[model samples]
Target chain A: MTKRIQQFLNEQKPATPCVVIDLDVIKNNYGSMRTHLPLAQVFYAVKANPAPEVVNLLVNEGSSFDVASVPEVDLCLSQGANPDNISFGNTIKKEPHIAYAYSKGIRLFAFDSEEELLKISRAAPGSKVYCRILVENEGAQWPLSRKFGCEVEMAEDLLCQARELGLVPYGVSFHVGSQQTDLSQWDVAMTRVASLFMTLQERGIELTAINLGGGFPAHYIEHVEEMPAYADAVMRAIVGHFGNRLPKLMIEPGRSMVGDSGVLQAEVVLVSRKSNDDCKRWVYLDAGKFNGLAETLDEAITYRVTTSRDGEETEPVILAGPTCDSVDVIYEKKEYSLPLGLKAGDLVQFHSTGAYTTSYASVNFNGFEPIKAYCI
Target chain B: MTKRIQQFLNEQKPATPCVVIDLDVIKNNYGSMRTHLPLAQVFYAVKANPAPEVVNLLVNEGSSFDVASVPEVDLCLSQGANPDNISFGNTIKKEPHIAYAYSKGIRLFAFDSEEELLKISRAAPGSKVYCRILVENEGAQWPLSRKFGCEVEMAEDLLCQARELGLVPYGVSFHVGSQQTDLSQWDVAMTRVASLFMTLQERGIELTAINLGGGFPAHYIEHVEEMPAYADAVMRAIVGHFGNRLPKLMIEPGRSMVGDSGVLQAEVVLVSRKSNDDCKRWVYLDAGKFNGLAETLDEAITYRVTTSRDGEETEPVILAGPTCDSVDVIYEKKEYSLPLGLKAGDLVQFHSTGAYTTSYASVNFNGFEPIKAYCI
Candidate 1:
């Protein structure tokens, strides 16, 4: 946790199961990316954390936006963001929503299929569009499937189809996955993306931009390479294929931009063993899969945790949320060691939960309100 | 879909991604449960669908409530439910919440561990408490882990401690699991519960009740036995051991009571294949894992889906929600056949979604509001 957030928690003593974001950390994360990956324009993925404070900071920093919906478009615009700086990033959108964004002066969009392309053609006519190519997400912690992108051949057809429908086929895009660790995966995606750019160029449809979608790593339980390592790998991969004259470049960073900027605090409601001989004690926390900590589903994103009683003797324990649903478990098979003295009312903080936590919380599930947030 | 909901959908076209609940279906479902399981008092599990309309209807029908949180307790009381009829049924609860429920005149509470029991004794002294025993959830579609219950021996010690701490050691409780299909699982839990009661009786701690926690199934894509069959099995198991000297038996029914009473309608935003030769088409709906359909996380609870065009030639489709998140895909591995002519703007209704769908929705995960609910 950042010093600002720690100080805020200490001074404010907000209720349990709330997240605190340090704007300084967000600014620093953005600055570090700018210092390293100088070739690409950064589009702060708004869906990561749509808090007005975060968006306002990014807007002041001259960061463009990657929005998923009309409400997100309005969020950025209402925060004094330049309409030209926003890109409608989600491939799935209602036709009316597309028209609304177009009316609000959004000129760039993302599409993976013909139906979406057709919608963009009619709704946001003449807008610059990028076709997401389906690439291998083998090494990402939160790997994506065939849900958001299409095959290289289909992407080729779709981008070409965009031009015929009075739209600009401006770029090609692909995401390795969220929380991507393997630098080589970028090389893999860039290879196919570069190949597609060439094929489209030969057909007299020259694409000028490559939207490098978000796959940057966040600080979690597992160690990942530093930002410079990612920047160097990405630069080298791009130069390896498209040597001298590069296309206009853009990067969409979601989790990496704000993930490490906040800490989520929850109180232990109860801790007990199922049986006398049970090996693991189940530690029930006031916050869980519903309110926050959704990335803990399947233990995919393991966040570093610290307790108020840290440094005490610890033992492996099962972690659960305060819900009647059986699937409300946070971590069970994955061994989460806790202080043996931990009991009801002990406080615990989950690190690097700033991205998907508050944004993914359920709306009053089991009569529990969504986790509250405080931006410092 | 019920005739009432169908007519309501036909007449009043509320926006897509809204659930229409037929109060008639809820009343009938409760009546059926009452007719079949005459020996057990009904406790409507409020976590399933805690709509004020649903709670008010059940209250008028003389149904007790199984509440998981303080907000739920307040919701029931605010809707004119008798405080005596509400059970604070969640094993995990905050001390302040317990006190609040107690101050509101709630007398019944659930506990599974010594720490929880201690909290209850300190907060809600003299409240009637039931100890939950860890039981096998075999043959359940959504099997629970060792999250909410303690071993039989642990339960015995806790109950004895409750009596010493000036709390009423009223009963023992166990859930087979949610969406449980196997009838024999009830017998398995009943045997353990009976053995615990006998052991407690020998120790001079006379427990006067046995709470059969919710394990009842909701009608989904899978065919389940009628409510009478479940009532018969539960009755047989309880009688085989208790031999007519039955305690004040209570059965908590969450999904089964309201699961079949509602239908959720969503519009097809787009439908396209990932590749030209790809056999399965990808169908994107306005609603997704975040807004609704959280139960389809692992395709565990498959709701019966019907499109506006149902009788045309059918093809297997990969269903997904309208969000940027990759995990938002509903049923990719599970083959859901849809009409070949299904396209954007066509309406689709998910049947048996009344219970868990609306209650589990996320709080605007991707700029989409929580699914609207209409109780007709």
Candidate 2:
């Protein structure tokens, strides 16, 4: 556990099975991003955490927001973020939501489909729009298959359609994938964005910005390159690809910004072996995929787990969430070792889980309360 | 689409991306189960749907409930269900929850661990307890894994311990698995239960009930044998395994009881091909994993999807939920054919989604509202 988390736990002794976020850590993370990418504007992805405190902290830090829906726009706006600084980032949106965002004076938006572009044109006439191009998401811990982006050719057509439909064809964007580890992936994605920018430029549509969607990774179980290293790689690639013709660079960092800042203190509900000769021990925690930690789906985001009991004989165990549903097992295939003497009431602190944990919590499953989050 | 759903849509024209539950279907399902298993009492698994209307209907029909938490117990009580008829079925529970349930006059409880037994003993002393035995969940669509239940020897020990702790050793229960297809799996599970029952009887503990637990499959992609056939098979297995002397039989049916009774009407946000040569069309729905239909995690539940444009030329498409997250792609690996002309404003109805759909909905992700459910 980090010293900060230990200190918080020692001081507060918060009820088990709650998310504790350190605002100071978040401030440091935001500062690092600003220092590393001086040329790039940071837009915090609200869907990752969406905690009021996290949003307010980022807003106070002079950061913008990448919002997906009308409520998100409302949240950012309520947090004192300027509407101009918020981008309606979701490509698939309801017409009413589009109109609501427009009514709120939020002009920046993203779309990958012609229909979506048309919807935006009708709902928010002449709004600034960015088309997202689909790219191969290789080496990403959480690979985004074909959910958001359109093909390069289709993106070009969509941008042309946007301009013809009276919507401003302002920029291009693409996500390398969430929790993306390979920095070279940005080089490939930026090259594609630059090529698209040049293509649009030839067609007399001068783009003003390039929205680099959220993918920056957080250090969890695996060692990841620091923010400065990612920034250097991104800057070098932009200069190599776009030269002096660089548009306003923008980045949406969800996980990297808040992931390491939050710690989940979950209590061990039970620990037992199914059979006497069974090799694996089962450790059940109060929270699970339904309550929170839904990112554990397929074990895509491996959270580094630490128990209060340390330096004891360790054994690989199957970590499961406390729910009636059998599918709530968190770590069964993956090898996760914990102290053999671990028992109920022992605090197991999951590190760097601020992002994607609380936001994905279901309201009630098997009657368990949603994972409570506390911002310190 | 089913005539009932079409009629409901044409008449009510409810907002898209909502769950429509057919209470008549639930009534018929409950009646059928009661008729088929005359000896077995039906405890409707509230976690499956938990919709107030569904619970009230079940309560009015004099059905029991298998609840997992205090809130579930409260829901049942609020719905006018007798507390004696509701069993606290979740094996892993907090002490406070046990105390709360006990204070509410709930007596029947289930546990699989010594720590849990102790908690129950302190909280709900002298409560009727059932020990679940871990069984091989082979041929199950949604396998339980090692999340619930313990070994046969351990179960016997636990039951004995429950008696020593002044709790009534009420029964033995086992779940064959969710969406279980093979009926023979129940026979195997019952045999194990019978053996344990005999062992417990020899040790001066008479088990009163046998909870077959929830496994009873719902009609999804495959045709399922009717409730009568399942009840018949279970009766024969019980008769064959235990001869003339039989315990009071009970079943907790979650998916099968309510799965087929619900229909989800989701609007197509957009449909497009990623590339010219791309073989599959991508169809985006307004509701997704975050909003509801989370059972699509690994495509465990294959929902039968229908569109308003039925009878039009059909094409295999990659179905996805509307979200900015790339992992929101629903059926990329599995082949799903949809109307070739499906577009925005078209309605796509997912059948047999009544059970797990609304209950698993997240409060808010990407600003999408939880899938609302209406009972008709």
Candidate topping DockQ: 1
lDDT of 1 by residue, A1-376 (tens): 8888989999999999999998898899999999999889999999899999999999999999999998899999999999999999999988999999999999999999999999999999999999998999988999997898899999998989999999999999999999999999989999999999999998889998999999998899999998999999999999999998899889999899999988999999999888888888899999999999888999999999999999999999888999998788999887889999998888999998889989899999999999999999
* Candidate 2 error regions (>4 Å): A1-8, B1-6
In model 1, where do residues sit more than 4 Å from their true spots?
none
All models, RMSD in angstroms:
0.9, 2.0
DockQ (C-alpha based) per candidate is 0.86, 0.71
- CAPRI band for model 1: high
Highest-TM-score candidate:
1
Q: Write the per-residue lDDT of candidate 2 for residues B1-376, one digit (tens) a residue.
A: 4578769889999997898888988998999999889889999999999988899999999999999887899999999999999999998887888899999999999998788899999999999999888987887888887788989998999899999999999999999888877888889998899999899889999999999998888888867787877888899989988889989999999998999888888898877676656788888889888777798878778888888898999989999998887778777777889888888889988889888888788878776778888888
Error of 2 at B259 (Å): 1.2
Error of 2 at A273 (Å): 1.4
